[model samples]
Target: MHFCELGDPGELSPSQILIRTEFSGITNGTERHAMLGEFNWNHFPGRHGYQHVGIIEATGNEVEGFNTGERVFYGAYVGHRAWHIVDTENGPPLLITLPDGMDHPYCALFGVAGVGLRCVRRVRVRPAQKVWVVGQGLIGGFAAQAARAYGAHVTVTDIDENRLSLARSCGTHRVLDACDERVFEQLKEGGPYNIVIDGSGYKDLFFDIQEHALLARRGVIGALAVRGETTFDWSMLHQRELSVEVSCHFAVEDLTILRHFVREHIIHIKPVVSHRVSIDEAPDIYTILRDRPAELLGVIF
Candidate 1:
């Protein structure tokens, strides 16, 4: 994608506010997929981000409950730049007031936290039950923590040892090497898991989970990562009568719930963030991510 300076959108309308971005979180899932032409709705030079924390620089006369210099957490499809115009009258709610003493960088992770919350909820995990997460990227890692918070025994797997290590530090009960062919056999020793989550965004791995992992009778399979087509044994699926559930983006209420998770310290924000860069370095960083996926996790811009 081409990057260059552009004139800022001048002056806010009556219900608008001008935001000076302090930090924006890079999403390895949607943004990476979009940049690679895998996301159908995004085109080349397409706007790229949905996670940012900023200060309200200017507010129109009609705007209420927001003041200049107020720190706010906002999300939109186009928030990677230094400045953004938020018209409250248009589109989904874009601004959320940052709680006192909340770290801006951590606020940028709210979206990811929400994804984890949603995915775990979809799986309908129960207390004391085993939950297997097949991927240890940011989302997967967070999903494992969320499951643990829900009182489930969480195990995470990934090909990247670094990511798996991060998951271990985040309190996952077990971390497995996804590349190992015996991974599923090992996982089954804990008994068939109540839920098996696919957060690796790897279609082949998802297929492998379907083929090898033994889920609890009528267990749930939650797809928390990006979706793609892959073939697996339909007969196996039929015989097991497994339930597959797919998750989408977070909703407004999900954000509210995530805020509570943060307050209660159920979601660990610090370990998930792995890199930091100025907005100007974003282009190069994206290139690195494209070439080497394991080199980074949560990146702040």
Candidate 2:
């Protein structure tokens, strides 16, 4: 990844605000896909970040409910930078004044957490339901916590022990090492999951779920991970009458609910944070992300 100067943002408009960024979270999966040009929408030499936390340095005269010096989370689509000029009336509809005592670093992860929340809500997770989350990366970990907050019995699996430990810390009912030889047996013990979420970005897991009969009849499958393509047996799906649900970017309401959960300590973000570096260190971090992704999580700039 390369950084280039885009010059000044120019003068702020009547409905705009100037922000000095404090922290920005990496949307690991999506950004990696973009970097590799895996997605059809990806273009060369493009900016790619959505999670941003910054202080409002200046606000337009017409701006209401937001003022200078307030730390807020802004989902800037223009990508990560040192400064941002947000048009309140016509900008991305993801600007919010963070609650008092919210950690700026953790707040930077709201974008990814909100995606997890949206996935859980879209699958209609309910109290006492059994939910299995594949993978314990940032999105998977957050999804497990969100499911638990909704009163579901959440089981999370991952090849990374550290991530599994993080999931356990976040209140997942069960954490399994996906590499274990008895993994399938262990999953069967918690079998017939009401909802299964794919946060691993591994298409093969979908077929594994079917082969092992891990999901209950009519159970919902949430494809929350980014992937190039997915292939599954049509006959198996028809026989079980299962439903497949998919969610992309989160909505504002998802962020609102996620903030409440984080404030209540029901959803944990700090535990998954593995790095906090300055903007200058971004290139090194991205190299690790490309070469050794398992070494990183919850990175903030």
Per-prediction tally of clashes = 0, 0
Overall lDDT per candidate, in order of appearance: 0.79, 0.87
RMSD versus native structure for model 2: 1.6
Find the 10 residues in a row with the least total lDDT in model 2.
86-95
Q: In candidate 2, what are the lDDT values of residues 1-301, reduced to their tens digit?
A: 7888868768888888898888899956777778888889889889989999989999889888788989888875678988888886864457888877877688998998988999999999999999999998888888889999999999999998888887877778899999999999999999889999989888698789899999999999999998766898887689999989998878778888988898888888888889988889999988988888778888888
Which candidate ranks first by TM-score, i.e. highest?
A: 2
Query: Best lDDT goes to which candidate?
Result: 2
Clashing residue pairs, backbone N/CA/C < 3 A, model 2: none
User: Measured by TM-score, how close is model 1 to the native structure?
Assistant: 0.89
Per-residue CA lDDT of candidate 1, range 214-290, in tens?
68778888878887675667765677787788897777677776777777877788777878878778878889778
The root-mean-square deviation over C-alpha atoms between each candidate and the true structure, in angstroms, is 2.4, 1.6
